[model samples]
Target: MADVRIIGLDIAKSVFQLHGVDDAGATVLQKRLTRARLLPFFEKLPPCLIGVEACATSHFWARELTKLGHEVKLMPAQYVKPYVKRQKNDMADAEAIAEAVTRPSMRFVGPKSPDEQSAMMLHKVRLMLTRQLIMITNATRAHMAEFGLIAPVGRGGVDRLLAIIDDQTDERIPAQARSCLQMLVAQLRLVKLQILDNDRQVLTLARSTELGRRLMEVPGIGPLVASALVACVPDPSMFRCGRNMAAWLGLVPKQNSSGGKERLGSITKAGNRYLRQMLFAGAMAVIRRAMQGTRRTWLIRLLERRKPKVAAMALANKNARIAWAMMMSGEGYREPMAIAA
Candidate 1:
C-alpha cells in the first residue's frame, strides 16, 4: 500500500506470495496472487526493486517485471538460505530474499533470455539421450558376453556385432540368440542416428550465434562447448574477471584458511555439470595431442610431471580461464608465451 521500495516474491507453479517493504525497511504489503494475476498486479505497482530466488520460471518473470519498469534481482537459492529466520515458510523465504538482495556482496544470477534457456534445454535432452545410448550399448555387450559371444569394446564393436548378426553364414550363434541380437542392433542403430542428428542440430545452432562463433576459436571448444557456453552464461560481464569465470565454472581449486595459513584442494566442481564435463573432455583431447609433439611448453612440461588425470584437470582449469577471458573481452583465443630457450 505504502511506497514500495523492495518486493520479495516467492514464486511457484500456480500460487505466488509477495512481501513488500518501504524505503524505511518497514513492511508495506503482503499479498498472494495466482500465476495469471502475478504480472497484472506488478504492472499496477509503482516501479520498485523486485527480488526472487533464482529457480525455474524465475527468469521469465524477471524479464517480464523488468519490462514493467521494476528493477529485478535474482539471488541464488543458497545465498538466500542464510538469511532465513527460524521457521522456513513462504513468508520467511520471501523475507530472506528481501534481505539477501540488499546485501552489497551478494552474488546474483543474471536472468537468462528465453532463447538461451531453450538452447540449454536442448543440450540437456541431448545429454540424456547420449547417456541412454551408452547404457544400451553396454547392456548389449554384457548380455552378448554371457552367451560366449565377445563383442568388441567400442563403437566399432557395435558395428561388428551388427554385421555378424546380419551374416547368413554365422552358424556359431544360436538362431534365437541371433534374432535377439538383431533386435538390439536395430535399436542401437536408431539411437546412434538420433545422437548424430542431435549433434548436428547443436552444431548448427552454435555456428549461427555470435558468442558461439567466438568461443569456437578456442582449441578444445567445438560446436557443443561453444553452444553450451552461450546457453549457460547469459551475461559474460557478470564475472568480474577471467579467474572469476573460471571459479564460477568450478575449475579452480577450493581454499581452506585458518591461522593465516591457506590450503588448497581439488576443483570445487560447482556450477553447470554439463559444461564442466565438456571442458574436461576437451582438455583430455588437447593433452593427448600435445603429448605427441616435441614442444616443451609450460603446460606440456607440467603434464609430463603430473598424472594424466591431473594434467587433464589442470588443462581444463586453464581452458576455463581462457574461455572467461574470451567471453569477457570479446576477443579470440591467443597463444600464451613459451619459455625462452
Candidate 2:
C-alpha cells in the first residue's frame, strides 16, 4: 500500500475496483472496496497519483480524492478505451486507466466544480421540460383535430383549440374527450410556466457572472447558450486555440486523410449534443434576422452562396471559435465591422 504510486479507480454505485502500481509500472495492489469503505481506504493510503474515468460521478470522486492530497487525473472513457486488454472487466479497466494516465500524450478531462455541475443539471431539466411542452402541445392538437377543430398551425391555432375547450356550449368535442384534453391543457400550462421560470434562472445565471456576460457579447449567444457554455467548458485553456474549441464542439468536418490526400466529411457531431444543438439554433436565429436586414455581414454573404442550414452550420462553427477566443483572452466580443475598421 505504501509503495503504490499510481492508482486507477473503477467507480460504480457500490463496489469500486482499484489497481495500484509503483513508479516502475509494476502492479503493487489489486483490491475492491465498497462505497462506504472507499474514503476510509483512501484516508489511510499515502498521497499519490490517482486516475479515474470521466463518467457519471467522476467529478465528485475526483474532488474527494484531491482533498485527500492525491493528485487526481480524469481521463475521458473513450480515450482510455484503447488501453484496455482483450478481457474487459473492472480489473482490466482499472489497469488500463493506470497505464493510460502515465502516458504523457494522454488527454484528460478537468473535474467540474459543484456549481458547474448544478448549472448543467438545470439546463438538462429545462430541456426535458421543453420537450414535455412540445409533447403536450402536439397531443392536444391531435386530439382536437379528431373532432374537426382544426386551426392554422402556430400559437394562434393552439389558442383557438383551448378557447373551444373553455367554451361550455361547444358540442363539437365530446364530454369525455374534452375532459381528457383539459388535463392536457392543464399540463401544458404548468410546463410552460416551469419553462419560463427555468429561462429566468438561466438568464440570472448568465448575468451573474463576468465570464457569462463576456460570452453573451458574441452575436449568436444569448443567456441559454452563454450559460451552457460556462457550465460545459470549465477550463477553456485546455484547448490550444479557437479552432480546437470548435472541433471539440464537433463543429468541424470529419477527416480521412492518407498519403497526402485529404477527404473531409460532414461535421463529426461528436461532443456535447445539447451544446451543438444550441449553437445551431442560435446561428439560425442570427441568419433569420440577417436575411431580413440590409446588413452585409459575413453570415449574410455566406447565406447568399450556400443553403440556409449549411450557412447556419458555418456560422455556428465560427461562433464557437469566437466564443473560445473570447473565453481564452478574457475579452468581450468585437463586431466584424469594428475589426474591419
C-alpha lDDT values of all predictions = 0.85, 0.93
Using Cα atoms with residue i matched to residue i, what is each candidate's TM-score against the true structure?
0.91, 0.96
| Model 1 TM | 0.91
Q: Write the per-residue lDDT of candidate 2 for residues 190-291, one digit (tens) a residue.
A: 999999999999999999999999988887899999999999999999988989889988999999999999999999997889999999999999899989
- Which of the numbered candidates is closest to the native, going by highest lDDT? 2
Q: Write the per-residue lDDT of candidate 1 for residues 1-341, one digit (tens) a residue.
A: 54889999999999998999998888888888999999999888989998999998899999999999999999889889999999999988888888788889999899998888989887998898888888878877776777777866777787776677789798877898888877877888887898898888899999997878988888778898889988888788898887787788888888997999999998899888899999989988888888889889776889868987788888877777777777778777666752232
* Residue-pair clash count for candidate 1: 0
- When superposed on Cα atoms, how far off is each prediction in RMSD? 2.5, 1.4
- State the local distance difference test value for candidate 2: 0.93
Q: Best by TM-score, which number? A: 2
